[model samples]
Target: MPIERLADLANPATTPRIVFKVGSALLFGAGGVPDREWLASLVAEIAAAHARGQQVIIVSSGAIALGSARLGFAKGGRGSLADAQASAAVGQIALAGLWSDLLATHGIVAAQLLLTLEDLEDRRRYLNASATLGRLLQAGAVPVINENDSVATQEIRFGDNDRLAARVAQAASAQAVVLLSDVDGLYDRHPSEPGASLLEQVKGVTADVHAMASGTSGSGMGSGGMTSKLQAAEIATRAGITLAIANGTHASPLARALGEEIGTLFTPVRRDGARKAWLGGRLRMKGLLVVDDGCARALARGGSLLASGIVEVEGDFRRGDPVIVRDQAGGQLAQGLSEYDAAEIDRIRGARSNQQEELLGYAPRSAVIHRDQLVLL
Candidate 1:
């Protein structure tokens, strides 16, 4: 199908679930904090979609902008990491309040969900987050999600909400992810330069897109640019979610993009199950697990790994590190984070958790690798 046709199909009028990401540059002007009139119009468009019975989840970026204003920092200050984190702490409340008040005006109830990379990285937490968001959609509530910046260290941060939005779209099985940015759409060259032309439709994210992108221009409100947007497009497309990069400066940009009258649409190459997509597209992994023959066969047959099947555990991976699930023959069957540490798994292997204390003097929860946590390749 043509990219525009795919985009038309993914519109809220045709599709049930949709995820929208609003960038900081679009949310706030050159100054900090949200533009009230702009936000009101944006909320109204989202409310219109809700009235049409389509589920919408918003991944918003503006906490730092709000925080910078609150802290009296200039837009392009060379603040330390701690300074940025502090600003997020102060700005989160003001940001949520804006959404709450704006949505309330349209008779739409909005809920705030603050997430860290850790939340999506751990299987149990990932399932919980997915279920919660799904329930909100079912209940006709729009979930406004943001990275938990106040507490998240550099090690656990999503870096920018564009990528976080893609992860949310995967979690929701969203038909599309609309990225609202300052620029209208992807351009053949830097939009700032003369003669740069906007590309209306992308068949898929290609090397050309990557080559054309430039990193953040030190605008300082948030740390994302054309490059990050393209990275986000790749993430969303590979997960089978269509993505549109549109200018959020215009009020109701999302509505315009959905109508296929505005923005650059990037068509998806393929789609996968929500959980499977999340598992496959993780940014990094923490450890490795080597299993025996029986485990490999069971996994191939769509069965879960049992404690009796594991042979060796490598590295100092904690309970939630993304581990390579390898067979005794050294072939990989799947990749999942272990639910237990290397030491714990080593002690509990080939035996039930109930038998742990009897053999090793201590017992933890059963099932070193829970079925829900395992994503087969």
Candidate 2:
């Protein structure tokens, strides 16, 4: 779609599959409890979209903030991971209850979904989570998603929901993602600087904008800084999903963005189907296979990775695990689920199919990785 058309469709009123992300700063103040009036109004706008037949998914951040308030701790104490986890345990319930109660006022049901990065990295777990969210959307229930902070260690945490929201948009095949932050939009320079101008529409987030962005979060409580938001934009745009960064200070901010008058719009690079986008972008590879030059050419021309073409296998990956197929020069050519285990692949490397039984006493399938299971990078 053209940039102008994307702008037109992103207007909060017309978006079909809309994914809105709410940062912690917007949901709470110094006291840490939610601003009920502001949250209520935000729910009203989402309910309006639902009434208009638009499918909406909300990625919210505020569990830690709410948890701090409920636990009677200061917002900034340099707490350990255990402290943060404790807060999340207390705040998650309040967060979900608030959303459910507010949404119920408009006769819309809200369902809570907690996820960790691990869920998106594993193919089977990813599919199961996707199917559950899909069913909620199909049943007309608004799904509110958050990172599983309680159980997620620092290594596995999403850190911020901005990136998670982008991944979710790809998983849900959403048309656009709305990032509601404390600031209005992307500026040529820091908004606090003199003569800084707001960039209305960005064809692409260039390196210059990225350089200008400081690693500063507008709200002290949120983890996503301007740089992280830019990172999220890159991820969403590359997956062919439009992204809008706007101010969440006011109620009905999404409605304003939908009007195409209030946000920094990042246009899509290339649109991809839902499953393809998820498979190509979200699934984490478990292993790698190095191929010869001839096999590289065939793969570049849209061929599969056959046993005869493979030179070596690396990593202890099992069958059906996502693996990267690289050339001898270390250039990634494709990604796919492997049909053979690493040990089996090592034995069958460079061997023809007919010689498989003679060498190994058993032949798995002919192809090492089938074409249908592979995605050319």
Local distance difference test values of all predictions, in order: 0.77, 0.82
For residues 1-377, write the lDDT of model 1, one tens digit per residue.
33355346344565678888887777787568468888888888888878877799999988877887888876432277777777888888999988999999988888999999988876678888989998998888899999988888778888888889988887777788888887778889888889999888887777777787778733556678888888788778877888888877776776665564567888877665666678765755677777778778887787766667778877888887777788877765677657777887787677755676776666555556665666654
**TM-score of each candidate?**
0.75, 0.78
lDDT for each residue of candidate 2 in 1-377, tens digit (9 for 90 to 100):
34454345544354678899998888887778688888988998889888878889999999888887888876442277877888898889999998899999999999999999888867678788888888899899999999989888867767889989998887776778889988778989999999999887786667787987878785678888989888888778867888888888987776666564777888876665555566566535789999999999988887778889999899999998889989988877788889988998999899888888787777559588887777766
Residue 362 miss distance in model 2 (angstroms): 5.8
The window of 10 residues in a row where model 1 has the poorest summed lDDT is 1-10
Cα deviation of 284, candidate 1, in Å? 2.6
Model 1 deviation from native, Cα RMSD in Å: 6.3
Worst 10 residues of 2 by lDDT: 1-10
Which residue pairs in model 1 clash with each other? none
- Residue-level lDDT for 241 in candidate 1: 80
Predicted structure 1, TM vs. truth: 0.75
